[model samples]
Target: MAHPLIDELTDSSFDELISTAEVPVLVDFWAEWCGPCKAIAPILEEIADEHNGQLKIAKVDVDSNQKLALRHQVMSIPTLILFQGGEATKRLVGAKSKRDLLADLAEVISN
Candidate 1:
C-alpha cells in the first residue's frame, strides 16, 4: 500500500489539514533537488498507505512553499514532522528507515 502525497500546502489549507484532521498527520518537508528527500519518499508513502485511515500523510515542498517551512524552522531536507491535534508532536530529520519511522510514530500515537 502507498499513501497519497501532497506536494503543496497553503497557510489556510495547511492549518485545516493538520489542525482538523481526525487522525495523526505526518508532514514530510522535502524538495525535488534533495537526494535524501527522494530516498525516503517511498518509505513515507508505504507508511501512509499502511497506516491508511489511522493517519494522514502529507508532503510539503520547501522550495515552492517557503512560509510553512520557515514557520516550522526547517533548515534541512527530509524533515518529518508528526502533528496531532494541529500541534507538532515530534520531528525527525534526515532519511530514516521504515522500522525506525514506524517506531517513532507508534510511540506518539500510542501516547
Candidate 2:
C-alpha cells in the first residue's frame, strides 16, 4: 500500500504535479505485478517522510498511464525519475537501498 506521504499520480495530473511543484518530484513508474516496484515502495515512503519539503514522492501506475510511461521511456518497472525545474534530472532503473537513494538524490537535488 502507498503511504500517506506518497501521492498517486495519473497522466492528467502528472504535468501539474511535476512542473508546478515547489520541490523536486520523484516519480515512480510502477505496475501492480512488479515485484521490484513493491520492493522500492518502502524506500520511497521513507524518503517522502524524511525529505518532506525538500522532495515530493509520487507514483504512476504504468498499466494505467501508458501514455505517460511511454513518454518517459519507462521500459522497466520501478523506474524512479527526479523532476526539477520541469525536467528529468536523475533516473534510477530498479530497486535500491535507502542509503544509495539518499546519496544519489543528494547529488541531483543539491545541484
Candidate 3:
C-alpha cells in the first residue's frame, strides 16, 4: 500500500473491518484495468494522510474481490463508499479531484 493508513480489504475481512471500525471507513472499489482507478490512487493516499486519525481508508480490488464488489453494488470502477456505523452513508462514483472527493465525503463524514 502507498499509504500506511490504508487497509487492503478482501471478502473475508470486509465485514469485520467495517463492523468493528472505530471511525468512518472509506472503501474504494477498483480494478487494475481501470484508468480512473489508477488516477485516484494518489488522491486517496493524500486524503488518508490528511485525515489520519479522523477516518480510515480501505481498498478492495474488484478483480480479486468480485463477491465483495457485487455485495456493495459497485457498478463502476473508482467507487468510493463511506461507511459509518457499519452502514454506507455516502458513495461517490468515478475518479474526481482530491478537493471534490473530500467535499463529497465531508457531507457524511465530518471533515
Candidate 4:
C-alpha cells in the first residue's frame, strides 16, 4: 500500500476523490506490469510528502480500471494528469525526473 498522502483511486471512489479535492490532484495512470510506472513511484511518493497541502497524488491502475483509462484517453503507462476543479489541466506521458515533474506542477502550486 502507498502512503496516506497518495490515494489509490478505484472506479468507485475516483469521481468523488478528484472532484472534491481542494488542491490539484495528480493522477498517475499505470499498471503493475509497467516498469516505468514502478520506476517513478518513489518520485510521486516524495512529491506527495513534499507538497502535502499544495497538491495531492493519486494512482489509477489501468488494468483494473479500463473504463476510466479509456475515458481519460490514456494510451500509455505512467501518464500523469493534473486535475483541478474536476477538470484535467495538464498531461505528462512517460517517465519524468522529479525536477521536470515539479516544473510542470509549478503552475498548480503557484495559482
Q: Model 3 reaches what TM-score against the true structure?
A: 0.94
Evaluated at residue 87, the lDDT of candidate 2 is 95
- Model 2 ranges with Cα > 4 A deviation: 108-111
Under the 3 Å rule for N, CA and C atoms, how many clashes does model 2 have? 0
When summed lDDT is taken over every stretch of 10 residues in candidate 4, the lowest stretch is 102-111
Error of 3 at 70 (Å): 0.7
- Write one digit per residue (lDDT tens) for candidate 3, span 1-111: 356899999999999999999989999999899999999999888888888878899999999999999998999989999999999988889899988887887754555
Expressed as tens digits, the lDDT of each residue in 14-111 for candidate 2 is 99988899988999999999998889888888788878888999999999999999999999888999999899988989888888888889854442
Candidate 4 per-residue lDDT over residues 7-36, each given as its tens digit: 889888999998899998999999999999
Best by lDDT: 4
Question: The CA-based lDDT of model 1 is what?
Answer: 0.81
Compute each candidate's TM-score over C-alphas.
Answer: 0.88, 0.93, 0.94, 0.95
Clashing pairs in 4: none
Q: lDDT of each structure? A: 0.81, 0.88, 0.89, 0.93
Query: Against the hidden true structure, what lDDT does model 3 obtain?
Result: 0.89
The deviation in Å at residue 107 for candidate 3 is: 3.6
| Candidate 1 lDDT tens digits, 39-105 | 9888877776666778778888888789989999999989999898889999999898888888888
